[model samples]
Target: MLKTLQTIVVAGALLFAGQCFAVDMTGKVVEVLDGDTLTFESNDGRLFRVRLKEVDAPEPGQTFGRQATQFVETLLKGKSVRVKISSVDRYDRAIAVLILPDGRVLNRELVSHGLAWHYRVHFPVDPALRALEYQAWKQNAGLWVDPSVVPPWEFRREKGARKPPPADPSAMDYNGIFDYGLIGNPDTKLFLWPDCQGYPEDSRGFAVFGSELHAQKSGFKQSPGCSRPES
Candidate 1:
């Protein structure tokens, strides 16, 4: 069953990849939702929420987020452009490549200006995009000016931190004092204390750490939703 599931996943990925290159359309920008998303209307007046392919921009609340959106608006608002449709994102936006009148690639432009990151986790890394990001990083352009710039993905995760069910009282352990081992989710790279409300009852796929420091050393960060106990 595990092998079958893997096969299904691979097939689905290939199907989506093929769909990405299967369509092209021309549209006028109707709205600028954020740095990475826009609403465009085709010649026939059908609207599509378009997300720039392979570029992850900062969320509105992040540093340079507003500047990135303004930049896009300056270049695209009320303008017509050609779109190479990729696939529909989970939010129902059309993932696409935008070609400006001057022949600039909008996705590349955002990265070149330090307004976005290459969406390497979701899409294969493009050498050009990586080079642009590095150049921007070196120059301290846009959001790069911030010393501790958090990736939009990480920002979103921390902002939307989940509140898991309270840890069961029966699960407590001690050595004269209450001892609550750290619970780490390797997938999310987040760890929670046993006393945290988000701590899990089931330990099936999680790793138990001897301490918060141990979890940190193992590349796990404390869950933002979980508060630390006084030391």
Candidate 2:
């Protein structure tokens, strides 16, 4: 039994190690599905659908959506690129970061050109890449041209929920709002306060109050509040 347990532990450790390293694959871009998705043909002639890590592109028919697709097409279509596959997503599509023959990272380059937004949760935080994004924003490149552009992830969530509009704008509270910007769903007034004990998710109105200097301004206390109403 001891020996068997040791073998199992060793196998687990090896599997974990393998997952940490990048799986390198060279392929030709056969299709630019969108800003963040593409199909590439490997040396073995198999096509793999890849999702670019750490960048979210505009969806079809969305503002700057067409422009994002066009930009990606210009950069990669019919071109040989290298992919460092990170993992398979829920759809079985390979999540990867593409590398150009000239050594530019496609993920970072896309963000630099304002064709994509940094997916902060998944993408490695690179100061240089972020700076490039800022530069693109300043220059009004691609999607940055639209100053009111929303992130694709947030767009999807809002579209999925199909929630009703807030009833009272003036009555809306903004307290206890920690990590205000990190909340993905802009439509939902919910904020995830990381600092609060138990770190509960509170409504945006509640968070606004919790966040305010005068806690008395909002009826709610500093404690975690109720979840925001749907939509």
Candidate 3:
């Protein structure tokens, strides 16, 4: 009797630990709401709004948004995934890392495919995510395929229009009109064409501008790379 009681106690403790870290469970992904959101059914028959951890994909109106959603749709195909439950968000969604049968981490794969951002705030636990993002930037994968890019977070803040890809990243003719972002301050704006050698890196604190007029309006005076004397 005592041995049975001990086994029960140990099992309960293991369950608690799994809850604190992450509960490993298999679930059929019934819906791919977006690139980063999904609905799944647990084996035991519980439904959950599963938010993919550590990646933020573009919103509906943002550039490549639909493509990102479609990317996940094509990947999942209403199939089952091994969900490692992380934490629950305020909306009661079971945030998790969904894994494919082939051993792909869905969250990492999204970022690797340039379909999402690493969401560094929620994911400092893994620097590999940051590396994946950087690699995507370098490879010009997905949205980064366009040099003048705005992160989804910045897009939400500015509510700006999405611009088309640069005609040519390697060309020096900026034409004073660009569909991407340029950053500068009151003194001088540092506008690098998407193909410019020193365009968007992971560095923070610089503001992104969609147009030359917008940059000028914001007091970002174009000295060199951004403008030419209107000849």
Candidate 4:
């Protein structure tokens, strides 16, 4: 039993060491570029653009995009933080996990609050981050309130194929009834515009909305996947 316990302890230590980051550094956040990206200034005045590893936030044009940025700014802007650098990306940004002064993990916090997505493509194996996202979704927190919420990666890919988004998306007719009408999911309490990628062809059990306001009045929220074009 003693020998078995010793072996288990040794294995655990090695596993932890394997998960350790390549570099650890302390810095103050100078600027919040977005939800998951920030400018970090070292004590000696050196600057590095740091990206939160395994986290992706909504784009500036997407729904809740500004909120995610505001969330990070509220928590870390101008505050000192410790970062564990895992690797440097091609864009010259350090992929890291930012640790707040109060010991909260910034990456995990973002996902837990539904302000960011767990970047599974880049760092796919973090079960904690995955579970946090699921919990946020289950609770309908932040962006999760939009039942058809688009992942940042998917949003980016879709955006790349289209013309530039308008300067003021709010000016678009969200409540206006278009020719194709709206697709709604009664179970999720979300309504998607006809052009939305998540709109289903089989609308058997789904509810229909005449306009955005009609859906809202009926206790349904608009999905981020439904980016209404300018009327």
Q: Give lDDT tens digits, candidate 1, residues 1-231.
A: 465335434533553666755567787887788999987667765566678988889999888889999999999966789888867766556778999988999999999999997765332357788788878877878877665466687568578333332265333221111124557987999988766776777866897664566678889998887866543
Ten residues in a row with the worst lDDT in model 1?
170-179
Instruction: Report, for every candidate in turn, its global Cα lDDT versus the true structure.
Output: 0.72, 0.62, 0.69, 0.73
Write the residue-wise lDDT of candidate 4 on 66-104 in tens digits: 999999999986678898888666565778899999999
Model 3 segments beyond 4 Å from truth? Answer: 1-21, 123-125, 161-231
Candidate 3 residue pairs in backbone clash: 169-195
After best superposition, candidate 4 residue 140: deviation in angstroms?
Answer: 0.7
TM-score of each: 0.63, 0.63, 0.61, 0.60
Q: Please give the distance, in angstroms, between residue 95's alpha carbon in candidate 4 and its true position after superposition.
A: 0.1
Which stretches of model 2 miss by more than 4 angstroms?
Answer: 1-21, 160-231
Arranged by lDDT with the best first, the candidates are 4, 1, 3, 2
Looking at model 1, residue 129 earns an lDDT score of 82
Minimal lDDT window, size 10, model 4? 171-180
